[model samples]
Target chain A: MKILAAVSRSTVARVLNCIQVLVPKPHVAVVSLDEEAALASKAMGVEFIGGPLPEKIYAIDEFKEYDVGIAALDNDSINISVVKALRSIGIPLVISLLNNSANRDLLVKEGADYVIDIDSYVSQNIAASLSMDKWVYVKPLSIVNLTLAVVRLARRSILGVKLGELKSALRSKSIHLMAIDRLGKVISDDSVELNAGDIILLTGIESEVYEASMDVEKLFRRHEETLARSFAESLRASTRPYG
Target chain B: MVFALKSRGKVSLIIYLATEKGVRNVKHIYKSIEDSISVVDTYIVYYGLGAFKQLMDIPAFHSEPPYCRGKAILSGVNLVTSPVIVVINGDTSCFSIDSISNAVAKVLSGETLLHLSKPQTNTDFTNVYRSFLQDILGELGITQSMLYPSYSIIVGLRKFFTTTPYSMWSIEQLAAINLREEALVVENNSCIDSTIDYVKGFEKTFVKDLARKAVEIALQRNTISRNRAEEYLKRIEAA
Candidate 1:
């Protein structure tokens, strides 16, 4: 496949370099005047077009030959323009990296096949890794407008809970406990008990998966509070003298 | 930031941050600017664009990089009704109130329309670069006041900005060249007192980044620096 990457910042170049490293078959070409981007392209061995991106970007002859175009510029406006430009010239697939999430809808409106909310994805991953006891990988099923989240079962709130009990709880909130990945075995049976390190698959309508995740984390916090209160009462009773 | 005495003229402060991921400092910078909002007509600060779009309560223009710097300056100056502006680096550099007010006072007065204050660092590389540039501009018949290193503060009117369109050249060099008669340069204790080192060289692309600025300006102005500037740039490259 002929892939053209519109590079501006070092971050985009770094990502494109990774793609080149892992899958070396595609003929990737990068067009940019940014010195950092140029250096990255040179090191990665992608065909580099070194010059200012002309105002009439669609008029460039080399762009017409590509099957896919990636607009990974730093600016949202430029990225939006590149998406439109690539579509105008009849490229089959156009992917764009969104700098600001505010422009997410705008990229979709203008001919971008896939809009990666790059900034949002990065920050969310960092925050999730820091706050959550067990990591969850979530992806949207665009056709159904549903969300699929694969959550690792590690929190004390649901460590020994039966799969049937957990399913009924999630079902009360319109979520499905799809499957379990426990020790390389797929468990669709709900009678099985939940283990500490089992990976639980969840599917729910658009925003419900996120809500369920938060609800699970909240349960952990609530458990800690009640445990603390009960422990304090026990301590008081133990210290009291027999009257 | 500027103050108009007659009928409460408008003043705008454009804080262009240099480094990235300095979101923590925005609140401190914003609070300080807010205190002066009563005195100065209007001011807006944003860290390298994207981070401040939703973070700050005040009205700010949030943008990503790759903007034409000349057009960016003009667009900012035009936003506020006032043509005067103060350009400062928010992320890496901070200035004393005394020096900031001094720069504003110099611009407000008839003494100079373009006032530039540079940060004083312990290193001598700045001094060396300043002298070398001074001699080069001198040879080109561009008379200037005792020019300092990179500009940390800029207080200038629309005329000064229009005269030297701030293209690829540093604002300090442009201000010195265009506002020669009405320009003032000062060195205040700057980067050393800053939270981090104020300035650093272009690491990966120094040769291209450095050569382009001087060469582009020389070519546009049709100056004699076109032929001889390469020799000086080579020396800079070697160093």
Candidate 2:
């Protein structure tokens, strides 16, 4: 695709790097009035369209031939003008960069097709990545709104339950027991004995899976605690002389 | 988990957000899908904002500018490594998880595209417009019972999306073009495009309840950050 990027020298590297990843073999032409910007574009072997703001963008004779145009100038007014010029001439797509988030509506009104604000865009992505461990990170996990969670059985009572017995219980909650990690190995046997410390991998809606995990943990812990209390009571009764 | 296991780093889900209304719609979509966050591999939520920061404070949404729906769909399909891609307009909301699952199943089961068609839900004028659309498609030698291309929820294969040139044209125009062969239509989904629709739509059974359920699930799963999800629910209450 042939794309025209109207950007300052500072943003050239980042823009080009993003284009390389996103677009497959884009024929990018860098447009800037700055000689330094032009030199950078030239060094990168990009087609350089040189001149001032809106005027230089308007001067491109073959504007319609370009598939998409990008206006990434740091100055909002200049970027707005450049985007406006591209749209007025019927560029198929015109995307502009925003320094200030406030100019988003104005740019869209001025005929820019898409607007991207750098700060919020970058920070949001970083934040999402940092918070990844708490949830699933599959490439398409949230598309269908499914998550993967691995829960370990901590108490012995619940661990005695066989996978066959638990299948119907899990199915009732719409949770699928995907794999069983016995010691260090992954097993898929339905008759596999339940053992404490075994990790069970589950896939289902987040809420349901979490609920199932909580229920399993609570049932096991409560059973074990009750069993211990009853044994102590029996011993106390046996030690009484009147009995 | 085995079924959920992805080969290599292949993306299993692609979410392209059409951001004409802003990022609130994007947040709404994410919130609605909170209950089923386990099946997704990765998601790309690009606001059709070219180079500007987003007006709405949805941090997880990426800001990618596209000229129109076509460009956004094409761009998203190109950028994401997923085999399945879902295109949703930010302004439209209120689709059931079952509807989404059904659509995804259809795509994975060999349907080229699934169009979430809520026929006859709009006004008389829109119905007439849809009939006109059917006539236009007829003239183009495309014979279909219904020609209204519902843009609320579109599910299809990434390859199918990339090969089909559905961009350049509006939803109706793309429908008239009739580019794909294995497209399926799903019905009963609803969208709130305007204030009137919002009011009208909510007057229906369980609309508010569904929103409440979505908010609750969103909070429980941390699908969106707690603060953002709560803030959104608060706005709805105040409204």
Candidate 3:
């Protein structure tokens, strides 16, 4: 669909570059109140408009310009204003950036088509990384998937057994062990014994995954907490004023 | 609507000083203004030391010395001219500096600052709560979430208890205690111990009443008519 994105210059450039890598060259229009942005977007093979906002808004009307108008501007007020102006013209699919949670109900009440909270999205990913077990930080998408997490095992731990033994132990739960990653590299063969920091990627439903991961997480939590506490203590001691 | 404070017939310059965290986005905003408003003059003042350094390095930007604090710098600018001085958070991931600047410009020009409501982040909650309090105190609207004393109170408590030997009280705990203490001080006048407590108690009541007044003002200003606002008030009362 033809998309008209109103954003700051750098963001527009970054978004355009990201879109270029993901989708085929699409009919995209970058509308900004800055000339440099228009030039930059034009360089990236997107349509650019550099004029007064109302004039630019009117200019888009001549062409079967855009189906979705994304007002990803940083300011909540401006995003809402742009959305309101677009909605006034009967534009479909008005997406906006809603930063503050208090404004969500108001934005919805005002008829915003879609509101994306980028901060919440990033924070959720960060929280997921901290909460999950045996997950890998997928560099490209920054998505923490189950496959990349490290599953900790103690020397005398019940799961200290080899991969085959652990698989057998987890068999009652019908959990499928997909792959094991150690120090960032995935091990191909399943015969290797599970050691400390050996993360086993498992595929299962919510209950199965929770049961399996919770066991590992509980075992590791104490050590992790101890290490964290000690590290914090050391940091504090180092920063203390020396008389 | 464009209130030109200067009689020099020159376009008034509105300098927006953003934190270093927001410099990259603010530069785009500067460029957008240059493109859109052919007559008006504009400059950007970056607040954070790091942001100031970055702006100094950029050949395009005419850098001024870093402003130590965002509000202080904004107030300083207000002293010189009445051009809209926009201040935004450096760490904001959602919007660019230019968009905020544009919005501020609109507000200064007497246009409505229309904002869409979304879910509040921890930062948003802190900011909104603080602004809500400050607005009640009849202060100029403060937008940045970090500037609120409540957030600092929480951070101070967290650091003091968790990282330092101050105590086991987290910032959240301190905030709750402070809030409860203020509430109790307002409710029971007998517990007033110090001048600070009395001031805080008065401020709390004033802010609460001001918030109620603000809601009334918002209702009047809202697109919904007086009848609708009254209906809303009735529904709220019924609930």
TM-score for each model: 0.49, 0.35, 0.36
Comparing 1 and 3 on TM-score, the stronger one? 1
Give a tens-digit lDDT track for model 2, residues B114-203. Answer: 445453345543443343344333434444644443445666655555444342323323432334433656555655443223233323
Compared with the true structure, model 3 gives a TM-score of: 0.36
Report each candidate's C-alpha RMSD, comma-separated, in the order given.
10.4, 21.8, 22.8
Judged by DockQ cut-offs, the docking class of candidate 2 is incorrect
Q: In lDDT terms, which candidate is top?
A: 1
lDDT (10s digit) by residue, model 2, range A1-243: 988888887888777777766646888888886788878777777788787666666676876688888898765646766787888778899888876554566667767777776644455445444441132222123125565555555445253566665565565687777545546776667787767666556677778877776655565566567777988999998895763
Please give, for residues B82-172, the per-residue lDDT of candidate 3 as tens digits: 2333322223334333344344444344443221111123333334345444432222222332223221101011111221111110122
Error of 1 at B169 (Å): 12
Going through the candidates in order, state the TM-score of chain A alone for each one.
Answer: 0.63, 0.51, 0.52
DockQ comparison, 1 vs 3, better candidate? 1
DockQ for every model comes to 0.07, 0.02, 0.02
lDDT of 1: 0.58
